[model samples]
Target: MPDYKAPLRDVRFLIDEVFDFAGGYQALGATDASPDMVSAILEEGAKFCEQVLAPLNRSGDEEGCHFDNGVVTTPKGFKEAYAQYVEGGWNGVSADPEYGGQGLPPSLGLLVSEMIGASNCSWGMYPGLTRGAMAAIHAHGTAEQKNAYLPRMTAGTWTGTMCLTEPHCGTDLGIIKTRAVPNADGSYAISGTKIFISAGEHDMSENIIHLVLAKLPDAPAGTKGISLFIVPKFTLDAAGEAGARNAVSCGSIEHKMGIKASATCVMNFDGATGYLIGEANKGLACMFTMMNHARLGTGMQGLCLGETSYQGAVKYARDRLQMRALTGPKAPDKPADPIIVHPDVRRMLLTMKAFNEGNRALAYFTAQLLDVEHLAESAEEREQAANLLAFLTPICKAFMTETGLEATNLGMQVFGGHGFIREWGMEQLVRDCRIAPIYEGTNGIQALDLLGRKVLGSQGKLLMGFTKLVHKLCQEHAEHPQLKAQVAQLAALNKQWGELTQKVGMAAMKNPDEVGAAAVDYLMFSGYITLGYFWLRMALVAQQKLEAGNGEADFYQAKLATADFYFARLLPRAAAHKAAVEAGGESLMRLSAEQFAL
Candidate 1:
C-alpha cells in the first residue's frame, strides 16, 4: 500500500495564486479566513489526514465494518481516528458560527475535505455525510430545529445522514412509498425503509440525525407531495440529550466491493419521531440542498482517489525497474531502467497528473463561486454566482468522477499484474472510485440535469454565464505574448461550446430522447473545455512567475508542461464527445431493451 500525502503545494498554489481566495474572502466578509489563518488550517488539516487517517485506509478496507443485529461497528482504528478528527474540530470548519462552528468559508472546508478524503475516504464518509445534512438543515430547518440539532452536529457529538434512496426508488423520488403522519405534538411519525444510507448506523458518533423524505396524509400525488423531516436514531430528551431509542434501526449493512468501512445501511424508520423541515410538500427542494452538496463532494471523491492513485503510481514508476527506454538505457548500472523511463508509463503518469490538477482547479473555482453565492453582499453578485453554480454542478459531478475513474484505472494499468493484487492496494482504489459515478444521481442523471434542466431549460443562459467568464479570461490574456496561443484556443472552444449547445437544443426539440442520448457526451465535452480554461489560467500564471525569475522554476515549468499536455492530449477528447452529441438519438434508441442482452 502506498502512503497518502496531501498535495499541499498545489493546494496552496490554487488557493493563494490561481483563485485569489484571500481577495474572495475579503469580498465575502470572511475576515477571519486570512492567508495566514488559512495556511495554518491547511497545514494542520494535512497533518491530521496524513498521520491519523492515511494509516487506517488499508486496514479499514481490510477489516470493513462489522454488523450485529441492529448495531454497526466501524473497522478497528476508525473510532479512534474519528475521535481525533472531532478533537481537531474538523467537522464544522465551515458550519454556521451561530451553531458552534468554526465558520470558515465553504471553500476552505472543501480544501481540508480534499485532504481527508484522499487520506481515508471511508473514514471521511462518516463526516462527509454529516456536512451535507448540516447544509440541508441550515438551509431549510426552522429556528428551533437548527438550535436543537445544529450545535451537536457542529460539535461532532452527533453525525447525520440523508436518507433518500429506498429498496424501490433511487432517482425517481416521485414514486417513493415512504409515509409520514402528523402527531399530537405537531411532530410526524416517519415510517419507511431507506437503503444505501451512508453513515446511517455507526458507533463512531453518539447519535445519528437522519434527514428523511416522505409523504404527508393529505399530500398531492407525485413529487409535489413529498416533505422533508429530521428523524434521529435516538430521539432527544427535554434536555436535548439523546434519550429514548427512536423506532429507527439499521436493518443491515451492505457488503460492497469498496469503501466497505463506510457503513451503508438499510435504515428502517418505524414510526420514528420526525420534525418537518421547510414547507410541507417541498421535501425534494430541501433535499436538493443536501444533494447538491453531496454531489459536489462526490465529485471531489474522484479527484481524491485519483490523487492517491497517482501518488502510488508515480512512486512505483520511479522505483520499479522494467524494460529499458526506447531510445537508450537510462539506468546503465541497473538490471533495467525504471518504468518511468518508458514512454507509455510517462503517458499514464501525465494523464493522471493532467486530470488531477485540472479537476482541482475546477473544484476550487466552483468552491469560490459557492462562497460568493453564500456571502456576497449584493443580490446580483449572489444570483450570478448561483446561476454559474447551477450550470457547473452537474458537469463537475459527472466529468470529475468520469475522469477520476479514468485516472485511477490508468494508475492501476501502470502497475501491470501487480495492480490487480489487493495487497498492493491499487485495486481497492478502482473499487472505491467505481461508486462515485453511479451514485449522486448517477452520471447519466447528471448529464440530463445539466443539458435538459440547467442548460436548455434556461435557453442557454446558464451556459452563457460560464462562457462569459471564459471569454473574459481570454480577453484579459489575449494580448500577452506567451499566453496568446492558449487564449485563442480557449476562445474558439468557448464559442464552439455555445454553438454545440444550440445544435443539441434544436435536435432535442424534434425528439426529447435526443437530450438523454447526447447529454453525457455534451457534459464530457463541456468538461474538457472547462478544464481547458483552467489549465490555460494556470499556465499563464506559471508563465508570469517564470518571467519574474521566481525561485520555484521547476514547479512553474511543470505546471506549464501539464497545461500543454492537457491541451495537446486531453482537450481533443471533446471533439469525439461533440461528434457523438451531434450523432443525435436515433442509433441509441433503435436498440430494444432485450437487444442489450446477449
Candidate 2:
C-alpha cells in the first residue's frame, strides 16, 4: 500500500556495472566486502526496507511524534523497527570494528542507507544522527571518550544528536551564546539551549549522547573560540551504562511540516557535565567532520524521497485510466487509455526517472571516493580523493536536493489530483523534502562553500582536481559512436565550467560580494556539469553493455534512454545558470533597503 520498493536492480547496476564498486572495494583492501557479501547485503537491505520500513512511513507521518513533560515519544512502530535495525547489526556495518562495528567500507553503508531513507526517512533520522555522532567521536574524541561512547553508540543501544543551532544562530556558529565553564574535577559544566536538534530526545534508545558546541570562558571572539563537548542525557555509571539523569532535558519539540516522527528538539542544557572533544576553541573543525557526512546523508534524503515519488507515480500512471492519448488510444480495450500514453505524462515520468537514476549514479560515485579517501595506500591517491570529496560534497548536498525537489514536484504533477491527497502519499514526501534544501547548511550556503571556500579558496587547485577527471572522460569518449554528441556536449560544458569559475573568481577579487551573488547559479552550473559527466559515463557503460549483449537488455536500454533524456532535457539547464553567472551581481545588489520598500 505504501507503494515503495527498493531499487536493488539499479543499485546493482551502479555498483557492479557503472562504478565497479567491487573492484574499488578490492583495490582498497576491503576483502571483507566481497561480491557475494555485497549482493547478500543488498538483497537483505532491500527486504528490510520494503517489508519492515516502507509500511510505517505513512503511519509515522500521520501520527508524528509526541512530547510529554521532557520526554519525547516517536510514532508507533518506530521503536520496534529501530530494535530490529540494531538487532540486525545494521548500525555498525561501516563503523569501526574497534567500537563494535563490522568494519565495512563507508560506501556500502551509504548504499544500504539509501534503501533505509527511501522506505522511511523519518525512521532513518535516528540511526543517521548516531552515525554522524560516531564519526565525530571516532575522528576527534579522546581514547577514553571513544571507549565510553563509541561502543554503545555504534551498537545502537544509545543514540546521538548534533546540538549546534540555537534560537539565535543557525549558520553563524561564532555568535553562539552557550558557554562552558571548567569544574574542579577536569570536566566542564555546559549551559546552553540548542534548537532544531534532530533526534534530540527520543524513547527508542537507552541513552542519548549529544555533541554540543559551546564557547569556553576565555575563548576568542568568533568561530575559532567555539569548542565541542560530549554531553549526555544521563550520566554514566561504573558499568558505563546510563545512570543518574544529567542536567540536559528536552525543553520542547518542534512541530514541523514533515519528518515529524523524528523529534527535532529544543534542548535545555543547564550546567550539564561535559567532556571536551579535540581541543578548546577548535569545535567547528571537529563538527565539520560530522557535518560533511551529514551533508552527504542529507543529500540522499532528496534521492530517497524522489525515488519513492517515482515509484508511486509510475504505478499510478500505468493504472489510472485517463483521457485518450492525443495520437489515439493505446489501450482501446479500456474506456480510456492510461496517462502513460500521453507525451506530457511521458515527459514528467522521464524527468523523474532520469533525475532519480542519474542522481543515484552521482551519489554512488561520490560515496566510493570515501572508501578511497579512507583506505587507499598511496598518500597521493588519498589526497586526490579527499580533494575531489571536498569539491563534490557541497554539490552533492545542494545539487541533489535541488533536482530531487524538482523530481518530487514532478511526481505530484504526474498524479495530478491524487498527488495532493494524503493517502496517495505524494504530498507528504514534498512536505518532508521541503526541509532538505533549507537545513544542513542550506543550499545557498552550500553554494557559497562550493564557489568561495572550496573552489576559489584553493586558487582553483581543488576545482582542477575534479575538472581534470572530466577532461579525461571527455577525451576518452570523444569518438564513441552512440554517445559522441553527448560526450561533446559534456566536454564543452566541462571546459566552460572552468572558464566560468575563473570569471567568477576574477570578479570576486574586485567585489567580494561577487562570490555571494554568483554562488548559487555557479553551484547550479557546476552541479549540472557534474551530473552530466556522471550521466554521460553511465550512458557509455550502458551502450557498451547493449553492444556486447549483456544482462537485461531492457534494463540496459532503459538506462541509455534515461541518459539520453537527461542530456536532451536536463543538461541544457546549465546554460541558464551560466548566463546568470555571467550576468554578475549588480542586479542582485541593486535594490537599496529603503528603495525596496518604496
- The residue pairs that clash in candidate 2, if any, are none
RMSD to the true structure for each prediction, in A, is: 1.0, 0.9
Candidate 1 residue lDDT tens string, 1-598: 7799999999988988898999999988999999899989988999998998999999999999999999899999999888888888888888898999988999989999999989998999999999999999999999999999999999898999999998988999987888999999999998989999999999999999999999999999999999999998889899999999999999999999899999999999889999999999999889999999999999999999999999999999999999888999999999999999898999999999999999999999999999999998999999999999999999889999999999999999999999999999999999999999999799999999999999999998999998998999999888889778778888998999999999998888888989999999999999999999999889988998899997899999999999988988999888999999998889988888999995
* Clashing residue pairs for model 1: none
The lDDT values for all models are 0.93, 0.92
- For model 2, the superposed segments whose C-alpha errors exceed 4 Å read none
Question: The CA-based lDDT of model 1 is what?
Answer: 0.93
Per-model TM values vs. the true structure: 0.99, 0.99
Model 1 scores worst on lDDT over the 10 consecutive residues at: 480-489
